[model samples]
Target: MLKKLLIANRGEIAVRVIRTAKALGYRTVAVYSEADANAMHTEIADEAVCIGPAQVAASYLNADVILEAARKTGADCIHPGYGFLSENADFSNACKEAGIVFVGPPASAIELMGSKRRSKIAMQKAGVPVVPGYEGDNASDDELIAAAAGIGYPLMIKASAGGGGRGMRLVEKESDLAENIKRARSESKQAFGDDELILERAVIEPRHVEIQIFADRHGNAVYLGERDCSIQRRHQKVVEEAPSPFVTPELRAAMGDAAVKAALACNYEGAGTVEFLVDKDRNFYFLEMNTRLQVEHPVTELITGQDLVSWQMTVAEGLPLPLAQNEIELNGHAIEVRLYAEDPSNGFTPQTGPLHIFKPAEGEGLRFDTGVRSGDEVTPHYDPMLAKVIAWGENRDEARRRLIRALEDTTVFGVTTNRYFLSRIIADSKFGAGEATTAFLQQEFSEDPSLQPAKLNIRQLALAAGVLAHGTVGEQAWSNAPATITPMKLDTGESTVELLVHNKDNVLSCRLGDQHHEIVLASIEKDTLCIIDNGIRQRCQYHRDGDSLYLQAFGESWSVTDLTHQPAAGANGAGSGRIQASMDGAIIDVLAEPGQTVRQGDTLVILEAMKMEHPVKADCDGVVSEILTKKGDQVKRKQLLVEITTN
Candidate 1:
């Protein structure tokens, strides 16, 4: 068995590996960046080291420094948990050269399966069905464009070396070919350091399913099962389930067999996933292979009754396969929803701030995998995934209902999250029926009014704020008289919530829009409030930053404004209109000029953030008076980007 294992990663994954390593009697070493010195992983390890700064290139991806940390810690093995260097071929080779065990696949296997184009060709050669496309070596732009035409319209241009849809684009017509190709190449270069691309005939409304396969050094491998990852947004999975509801035994066997074949072809070892795009007709074609433990691995673990991380460790120590294909049994169904620090109401833009309240749901058959806690800040330097909530049950409907209940009961205040949105997806009739496709979000949930939070009076919030900003019956309580007193107004930017309030005899009554709710401060703790509303007590979690309060209640997180005492504002950009940066990000491209004419909906600027491109369009017809920021400039949220003299 390996003696000491150094984790070359961070967040929940590092913590996850550390727990398993410790339980298996192996000492663990944690590596962190400057920003994560006080992180949970660092705190939990037997030993810790600061690798570099918060920037990924300087820290997590810094292979040499990570190796040095291993050497200094006298670790016998380096476990590149999932991201960062988990699939980096060079890093694996370096670990081998340093006489350190790389707890993953062979460097040669990563090299073979790392690129989508190469992997597809290998699969094709191994008799696995693959989508027809162009993956020729050293192809020019014109060659790729020509190949796209050959592949026909409505094809996908994918980064030859990408996953998670970083460098993928769908071209519906010939007019979009050039621009899509250019953007794809640029994004590919930035994400994977390879500008090469592969073209594929788009599989319409396919069910995204992947088979989990594990191999050992002794030429033994077995496919565990398949996971349905069809629920997606921007081409990344949002919800994943084990023992796919849409897959029958016959289809599962075929997919599993093909996955085993692919593993064998690569001379694979350790844990890997072979993904496929299954059409409505049950015809599955080879998609890219992910050479690491997936984010949704818990669902598989729940259904299979196995600890995959342990298998990886045992295999890394030169052990044979843990079990044969016949020994493995899929016992139950499991579903997992990714909890992200993102605003679903807004284009799923990643949110950053302190998690004033990070409470994961608890019950039978529930597993919460998280990193951050209350008071921890959600930074822009890392992925926005806050946690993974997995629920297991005896059947698909049982699992689905359990997942829905858990998701709707969870609370994560301070940062805007997709928690509410995840619940909506799982509760939908189509999703519960296992009819979710790759286009599920775009087709059924995009801008769905039902997903938006129900609007409430800011005055009730102000009353809660009054208790939070001061305290119940404290030195800061609202003062000076007939306590059933004055009226106040709160502007939420979208609407002004008028309020008539007073606090007397422990009863607080506030009226809003022909409705009234009597509020009594039951209790108050730091970031938590217990309010008695009309003889019923309800507890809520909240964090106040100036006039904005991020609160959580009834499985939803929201940001409310308390403008009880601010000057009334004119319409946004009332006079000299300027299109401001919607969020803090880097300017990738500028389509408007200082003197350019623009219409109400023409793209004026493009910003790249959280690994996605957001086009900023003109809100009104105007002549651009000034362009404050240029391409490649880093911008702050709400900063003036393009000044326009509206007609």
Candidate 2:
């Protein structure tokens, strides 16, 4: 067994590996960046080291620094958890050269499977069915454009070295192919350092199911099970479940066999996942092989009753397969939802801030895998995934219901999240019937009103007013004088609402325009407000940050700003011409130059954040009067990037 193990990653994954490694009697070391100085992973490990700054390139991806930390800590094995350098061939080689065990596949296997182009060819030779298109070495712009003619319209240009939807684009017609290809290459180069791309005939409305395969050094391998990751946004999985509802035993066996064959063909070892796109007719084609433990591994663990991380360690120590194919049994159903610090109402933009209350629901058959707590900071230097909530049950419906209840009770107050959105997806009729496909979010759930952020209703506004005046109301609880009427103003994102509020004997009367509400405050404990709105008792969670308040009610989160005491209005050039950064990010591209004429909605700058690119477009047609920010500049949210004089 490995003596000392170091985790070359951060967040929930690093915390996950550390717990498992320690439980298996291996001394665990954690590596972190400046931004993670006080992260939970660093705090829990037996030993910790600061590798570099907040940026990933200078920290998590700095293999040399990570290796040096391992050497100093006397760690004999390094586990590159899911992201960062987990699948980097060169990093694996470097670990081997340093006489340290890389707890993953061999360098050769990684190199071969890392490239989608090469992997597709290798899979073809191995008799695994693959989506037909182009994976040739001729990757020049013109070559790709020419290949599109042969592949026909409605094809996917995918980054050869990409996963999680980065550097992937769908071209519906010939005219859009060239531009999408350029975008794919640029994004791929920034993400994977290799701009090589592969074209595949788009498999419309297919179910994305991946088989989990584990191999040992002694030429033994077995398939654990399959996971359905069909519901997606921007090509990334939003919800995942084990023992795919859409896959029958026959399809599962075939996919498992193919996944095992693909693993063996590349001489793979340790834990890996072979993904496939299964059409409506049950025809499955090779997608890509993720050469690391997936984020959704908990769902598999719940169904199979196995510790995959421990298995990875066992394989790293040259142990044979834990169990044969016949010994493995898929027992129960498990569902998982990714809890992200993102605004689902606003294009899923990543959110960063202090976590005022990061409490996940606790119950039977519920598991919360998280690395941050109430006081931990969510930074912009990494992915915004805060936690993974997995629920297990005896049947699929039980699991689904448990997941929905857990999601509703989960609280993440300070930062915006998709907590409600995840519940809505699982509760939807289409998803309940397991009919979701890769296009489910765009095709089915796009216009679902429940998926959008909840606007404050009259009851919620009354609750907010009562909560806002809780302290003062409590002080005047026994006062005999008539209740004082106070006028206040609140900005509810949609529009400003002026309200009249006063508390008498713990009952508050609030009037917004012509609407009047009588709310009785019952109790206030640790941010949970219990109030009776017109005789109906309600409990909701809220967090107040200065004048800005966030409330969690009605299975959705609402933001309100107390603008009562502030100045009312001012004329501004917000929508007329100024192009502002929508979020805090680094400028990766500047498309507009000063004095250039551009149309409204024309993209002027590209901002990269949280491993995704967002285009800052011109809000109005005009001549570009100034290019305030250039490429490589770090900008804050709402910072002016361009000044356009409207026509």
Candidate 3:
């Protein structure tokens, strides 16, 4: 039996495993990078060790270093949480050689199921229906192009050794195949260290359903319902729910049996997920098998009433199945959304900064799993996902509504986030109707008005003016004097507005561009502001840092800047001939140099951050005047990379 557990990952997953391991009477050790010195996981573990630098290759993915940390901490077992080296077969073998139990399946199973090409071939032999595609060993661009001819257009190119949308692309025409293949290969090599590509026929409008299966050392396996992860952006899951609304009782059993067969094919043990694409007619085909716990496991846990981490421990100790397949039961419905530090309006580009205020709403049936707290810095060295918000109810609509409310009430300031975007998705008509498929985001909700950042209205402007005026203790000395008119100028990124405020008798009268209003400040405590806006009692949450303020109200969030004291004189706007870095990242490629002629929309530089690539392009036809960055240099957001003299 294991007495000490070491987590071989970071962020929320590491914290999650440490909590469960401590409750089971085992001492837990946490391994972190130098960048994560003050991270939440390190603070909660019984013992903490710094493995290496912030780059994953130097830390989390460094199997040798992680093993050494476990040995130094006297940990007898290691839990490879999903991501970094979770599906690495060599890491599993190394733990066995070191005489430490790895809380996952055997090395042989991981090796077989880790490759999408190999797994699809294995599933075909195991009598499981597989997607029609090419899974050959030859991954050359020429070979893949030839295979695309046979598979036809509108097929998918996937990285053989990767998942989670990395190294994946949808090819719609013959003309677009080669470029997409090149991009797919490049992304695959960067993300998984494998440039192998596979071709598959795209399943149109299919529901992304996956079965959760668990096995023990003994010959027993059972499936725990299913999770519908059809709602996605860029093939990354945005929302996931348990007991899919599209799955019937009969269909669920069939998919579950197939998942168990796939698990038993490689002599699998521990937690695994088998994903499938189910057509409108209910025909399901194998997609891929995830050989570790999934990010959306909370939904399954809420429905099945089981702690999967505890089961992993029991199975690692060579136990039998906890319950028979027939005895397993699922109840209620649960939905979850991934809260990320990103700007949805700007193509969901990742954002990084200090988290001045991070608070999850508290309520029954609500579960928040997070890794950071107030004042934590969101760096570009790791994934931008901040937390997971899950809600459970007796039915689907109830769960959806509860999730919507939770996302709206949750507060995250300092950096831009997708809190409001997530609320809009959950409240969308198609999502509320339980009719969303994989094409929901692209085909149906592509033009959603809520995708843009909220515009500052007069009401919110009045409230901001009132908040700015309320805290002035010295200014109140002029109560006996006539009404004092204070001028304020605020910028909301999208636009700017100026207003005049007069404070008298706890009422703030404000004027903006010939419009007048009165806002009564009912009360103010900490960050919460309770006010009566035009006879309507409402509340808003805010965080102030000097002249900058972040506010959340009316189901939207806004960042207001005080520009009253700053003088501005320039016609320079977005197309100012200056290309700036969108976020802090490493410069992978510099496409332009001094004296180079460029056209509008030409790629100037490419930056890699949060495990993805972002290209900075020219905004107008021009000649490059200066290039400030080079390959391999780290840069900050809004830092100038290239300057061009426009025509």
Candidate 4:
């Protein structure tokens, strides 16, 4: 076993790798950007190094800095975790040249699998089923149009070097092809530094099934079964599970065989994943291969009862195959939900704030991989993924139940997250019936604003009432003389709540409508309160800036403004305004400029943020007055990008 290893990444994945490295009696070194100087992963590592500023390119993606950190820390191996340079062939080669183990597949394998076009060609040559599309080098527009016609309508244009759903466009008609292709190319170049693209037939209602394959340098390889990752938003997976409910035993065996073949074709070694797109007819086609550990690898670990990180270390240490194909057995069912720092009610936009309270559920067969803690700030400069919660049970239903329970019990305050949305999804009737597809969120949940809380005041009231019942009001408590007891009334547009408080013996009792409850005072600070109610404690953090009370509960935050105090006239200014940039990003395209007359719902501009492109559309019929930002210009949130003059 290695004595020490350096993790060349950040966030939950870095923390995850550290835990396993420590379990194997290896000292861990964590590298951090300026923003992550006080992050949880850095605090947990045996030694930490500051690499560069907050920008990923200056820190996490800086190969020279990472290698220098490894050399300085005396680490024998460097674990890329899952993102950053995990699959960068050059980074792998650099580690090898520096005489440090990369703890992943060989550089050649990464190079072959990292490019989608090249991977498709290799899979096709190896006799593996591939999607019908064009992977040729011709970039002519006419050639692409011909390829699309041959592949039929409703094809997908994807970046050849894309991952995490960036640089992909779905074209259902020929008329929409040119613009989408241009957008995809621009986004692909901006995201991956590669503008190369490939077109493929869009598989309708497909289930994403991926096989985890491990190989030793000695020409031995084995597949650890399959994981179903059909629950997604914008082509990015949100929930994943091992031993898919839809995959039959025979189909699993066949996919496993094909995955092994793909690995052997590249002389692959260490850990890698072969992803496939399974259509409604159960026909599977090779999608691509990930040449490093995946974000959802916990599900596979749960079912196999194997520590994949340890295995990676062993393989890097030149150990031969320890388990044969026949010796591996599919155990129980396991499911994982990725908790992101995003607001589901707002098109799942990314959110940033301090994590005032962070708590993870604990129980049998429950696992949590996290990177942040209480008081840590989640910045917008990195991926919004907060943590991965995994649950294992005897079967799929039991596993789903456990996962839902775990998600409900897990609490995060100070920023918005998708905890409630995830709970709703896992408990949905269709999801429970095993009828999920890649379009699950878009078709059933995305457009339905009613599925999410229109107002979080009810939950906020519950938490606040719980806090007031706990007598933490300090010197503001009512005097022995009959003092004027002020009743707190909260309105949420749909409902109203009034709380009556009585305090004695450092304890508080409150009447909430027809129910009476008691609580113990924990602490009370400026603008926030913490309390214990009926032996179950919950922390309620709120800010009373003037008449507005911002309440955050269970990772979903909302503001309750006092309607009694009306806003000053003309506070918002002007009669009509053009839709502005909602967040900091690069302007990918200007679909409409000055003097262009457009109607409501007409696309005006495309803004790319966090590697995803968002289309900003006209809200009303108007003629464009000005276009302030051009394509490739970086913009800030609420910056004026366009102006319109209504007729």
Candidate 3: C-alpha lDDT: 0.89
Tell me the number of clashing residue pairs for each predicted model.
Answer: 0, 0, 0, 0
- Quick one: how many clashes does candidate 4 have? 0
Worst 10 residues of 4 by lDDT: 566-575
* TM-score of model 4 (CA atoms): 0.80
Global local distance difference test of model 2: 0.88
* lDDT, candidate 3, at 206: 94
lDDT of each: 0.83, 0.88, 0.89, 0.81
Error of 4 at 280 (Å): 1.4
What lDDT tens digits, residue by residue, belong to model 1 across residues 1-647?
Answer: 67999999999889888999999999999999997898888999999999999789999999999999999999999999988999999999999999999999999999989888888889999999999889988577899888887889789999988888889999899899899989999999997799988899999999999999999989998999999999887888889999998999999999999999999999999999999999999999999788889888888999999999999999999999889999999998999998998877666788765677787778888888877787787766789888899999999888888888788777777667888788888888888877889988888877675356446554445455445334333342334345655465554433555676666655666666577667776666666667776567887767666666666666665565665555544234323356877666789999988888888878999987676688887877889998888999977666789878888
Best-fitting candidate, scored by lDDT = 3
Q: Compute the lDDT for candidate 4.
A: 0.81
**CA lDDT, candidate 2, residue 221:** 82
TM-scores of the models, in the order given: 0.85, 0.89, 0.91, 0.80
Whose TM-score is higher: candidate 2's or candidate 4's?
A: 2
Q: Tens digit of lDDT per residue, candidate 2, span 1-647?
A: 57999999999999999999989999999999998999999999999999999998899999999999999999999999998999999999999999999999999999998889999999999999999899889489898888889988789999998887889998999999889999999999997789999899999899999999999888898999899999888778899999899999999999999999999999999999999999999999999999999999999999999999999999999989889999999998999999998988877889866788888888999999999999887777899899999999999899999999899888887778888889999899999998999889998899876556656777778877877776443343324367899887787755678889878987888887788888787777657788876578889888887777778876777777787777643212334576777667889999989889999889999998887789888877899999999899988766888988888
Q: Which 10 consecutive positions of candidate 3 have the poorest summed lDDT?
A: 472-481
lDDT for position 628 in model 4: 90
